[model samples]
Target: MPVKTENAEQLSRADREARGKDAQAVAPLESNAEFTPGPSRDPVGLLLEQEKTRVPELLPVRHGRMLVSPFTFYRGAALPMAADLATTPTSGLRVQLCGDAHLSNFGAFASPARRLVFDVNDFDETLPGPFEWDVKRLAASLAVAGRENGFTAKARRKIILAGAESYRTAMRAFAEQPFLAVWYAHLDVEDAIAQFRSQMKKKRVKATEKMVAKAHTEDSTKALRKLTTQANGQRRIISDPPLIEPVEQLFPDVRVDAIYKLLREVLGKYQRTLQSDRKHLLEQFTLVQVARKVVGVGSVGTRCWIALMDAGDGTEPLFLQPKEAQASALAAYCGRSPYASHGERVVAGQLLMQAESDIFLGWTHVTGPDGVDRDYYVRQLKDWKFSFPIEQMIPSGMAAYAQMCGWSLARAHARSGDRITLASYLGGSDQFAQAIADFAETYADQNDRDYAAFQAAAKDGRVQTTTDI
Candidate 1:
């Protein structure tokens, strides 16, 4: 896809029209008339733009080689993939897309109602896009994951089919439900456990029970131990050389004291982004300690800080993550988003998609010593968030988990998009589902090729990777 000036102008007009149509269709639905799409930049150009903005200390020497393989390509190509999808055929129905809705992105978390729930957690690539894009990405991920887990080709196909079918069936059911009921529907941990027990019979259910039991027992101490290590006398993030460099190693130019001061200032601004009631509630929490943590394959080099705050006493520690924000991968292709602040855009999108969100959700702008404006959003890092490990899931278990993800994604979409119009567009057919399933299989192959290319590049010294611990 080329960055057509004409496409940019057309997108702006379409966005305004969409917002107007949305407002007229429903009063409660928020009108985003001012939300202009970014320039119609092609996928590779968008990826290059993102690569240019990455923290210099975090950049791999073989960044070019990393882009040569399909798998490495997938990781770095999120912005481009999103841009390409924007130009593809669609029903013209929009939703609160998870932007990067791969199988790994869906996870468990505690709901506002104090119940453990599982849903989509990562939203870095989130934006308003055709609803099917998320579904396709998710289904393709299931296929890739299934193959990695040693599932037969036929079995992988079943997984993809089941995943897509579940989404189609769930969306239709949700569309028929009353608005309030649909908005409030969510699967709590207990509900999930009950469902699992019924499906797996006594023996299998007992096995699953052990996993859940272990998960429930996981506390801050265990999480801290897993994510941190003892360095000299004080605890610090474990540095596994290039793959997991400590903050000090990555930013050698900045003193530790300066980092701490800047962090405190950033935290204060994050608190202010909360609603008055939430801010009042946050006042009771005191900062206990902070550590630099590296997480996720795609986000490895980005600045991610974890702060441990004491809520009441030593027993109750809240983990908050102040993650770095980049411009939406969809922004350039879609045209610059109307929102001035990317952090605000993320917060708004999360609030719109989630049934309830962390009370402390907010963002702030911080200029690093390097003179680059760094955008960040802060929220409770881990408040009873959990997920079934994809590698450990059996075919039946994977199917069940995929259905849950589909149901949740549909609910999120229905909440943000014009459901009536969307339902009408989908009608009573499986055509869309089949189309996406086919697309997912093809894309999964593309991803495998990309991953292989990345590995080969690394082996050939074209890409630099630190595999050994």
Candidate 2:
């Protein structure tokens, strides 16, 4: 997958810096502060349009989750913001975007090397677009979350600025590094804790340590103990309705054996996409059973499944998640993805943006019984996964998290975009960061307005919430 500004790599360092300066000259840093939505914009209607692409029966669940709060609504409203971002000025610098770079999207997971690392963990709406778009998405998420947490206006501004400033400074630092150095760069969670350990109180450090310990306990073996039960002397996924429905329950008309056979075939196709080493590793296990699972506030309506596999010796259990990948929300404003399938688009974007990727990461195109084809990407489930407790964060804790997210985002963008040019456009001052902070506050206001309109629609029966399977 080629980036929009790949040609910049051929230019000399001086020339690349000049290109950034030229972009800054045309779109000044202060110009990014403006946020004027067109009069005809209909946020609720935009969401209604996206609803058409999701699983019809699960629509209410998505709506119910989004209606939980304004921040929740913002999570599912990525398309509307993509449209809003189209109206903002760009620096003309493009990168493989996370497209939905909210704070919750950044989390800790085990890298292929078995090291705990923090990076952007979601790429469902990834595509190539203006570098500012991703940064703004991240900054705005902070503002919205801060409001939900009851932070004061001044405190929220400080948190947002911390993220934006960290991004600018980090990009400048990366601009001075060699290509290989930048590509190999990563943020180890342990190292992060050590760096902050000195600055934090004893109780805070202990809490952080406890989180890391908990992550180590999350793996295939633990998942087997929690999500499966002995039935007919064979392991099977437990039925939990709406949230986690077993194959037998989801498709009563289809034979269980045939469903397992199809799952075997899907995994076979998916394995071909992995490297030779990983393909061989996957061959050691046999598929046990699968379950349909609803995950995340924004992804509730997607087709997601968890596959359980057992080693012949019956000791190691492996869990793999195959999730549907639709066309990116950013595709409408930025050009269509260069990849032939949305699955490949997600896998390619994840590989480009993350310092390290899961060994089993792969994509496949499957034809369902309804004669419709869909794209999906596969990865291990609950493998040392952990999310920051954003709702419980104090202002100082959030400020620290803001720095890590910002630094991580800059590193990701630097790998795909021209770092020298972006650094030049940002300059040495805090002007661009200040402008983004302003945009974040304004965008949070827009999110509230959209939430209010959505609530009204719910009253008129345009949307409803239910847990009935």
Candidate 3:
């Protein structure tokens, strides 16, 4: 389907009035509700189960040095927390939320028009859930990441508050804008840089420029060079044991071959999922190489395969990521999704949330050797995708960055949700902001304790981890 585009002027006066009224109504609910806690389960056991099922390789050891860090452990434990969070009370406001809205998840990528743009890139944990879940997760992640970056506690708190305030402020602004104006909103790099230029000091602008330049360094060729290495003159994914596991690991039971074959079959299915025009465009491409590439802290062990396909020329290639689709954590609380296939759910959600998406977005089911069907969602692995290094940002820069994330996230939610109801719930006041800020501080504390507990567990031989990547 062609991307939906709305001009600023398309937003009618009546639409603006409706949004303002809606925001006025929903503001009261923010103070009325309390955060419901997740189930009182053994967090360690839950982490282990998720690790075993999705990414067992991350559980191994290398060189007698286990790859178990508090951070890595926290990444693996989202499933249990998701389950627990589901049972809690919510504002009854739902959106197509990023199931895992960590700070690291926001990034930059090239649009289909070849224009560089920034937005949320990771959607692995995506599902329909309470909007506040995403906001809290993002705010807490900002705190954790800021702490890791050597920022002062006050700086970290300020960053989190800035992020929350941005969301609240942006939502109110969006609530006041006409529907079409809200729909048309987006942040291009030039515009983003300009916004930063106005808000930040000269030194900070230089720093942000440097960061943007660094992100630009990792284009398609750079991605290919990093992902593929020379193996007898044939470019292939480097098979570094523990880190880059070859298909051989999943073989012997012939599961590796099965997965490869299934991938080809699924690619064909994915093609069918596209509109005919896109399928024709894709047909011009030829498959070159396929490899199992472990990626990210949370997705370290999930079945992630990358296919390098050549377009018109051998040098021009597109990378496709067919990631394993596990059941969504939001499913329990949000109730059953109407989507019969998990892949469909992901594809549909992506289409709804993203302003523009890869032409290859689709899904398929692959039956494993155990006769169990695993759902898979396919998309461009990295088509000019980029993210700022959280560790590199200064306190003020981080705060500014958090605000951008909040604004982008609110826009995304507005696109896929009932704006009137959400605006009504959020209201014009900062009560929701204050509430989220309070929740974020508490959750950050909880996250630190959980992170510490995970480290203790690792040290005590209660859980296993592999750190080499």
TM-score for all models, in order of appearance: 0.81, 0.98, 0.85
Clashes of each: 12, 0, 7
What is the TM-score ranking, best to worst?
A: 2, 3, 1
Colliding residue pairs in candidate 2: none
The lDDT values for all models are 0.66, 0.91, 0.69
Model 3 agreement with the true structure over 240-330: per-residue lDDT tens digits = 6665655646455676556667657768877888889888987888776676776676676667777877785446767788888776656
List where candidate 2 sits over 4 angstroms from the true fold: 467-469
Model 1 residue 28 distance off true place after TM-score fit, in angstroms = 30
Full-model lDDT, candidate 3: 0.69
Candidate 1 structure lDDT:
0.66
Top-scoring candidate (lDDT)? 2
Instruction: Output the better candidate (2/3) by TM-score.
Output: 2
**What is the lDDT, from 0 to 100, of the residue 14 in candidate 3?**
62
Off by over 4 Å in 1: 1-49, 56-77, 196-198, 201-203, 219-221, 225-257, 311-316
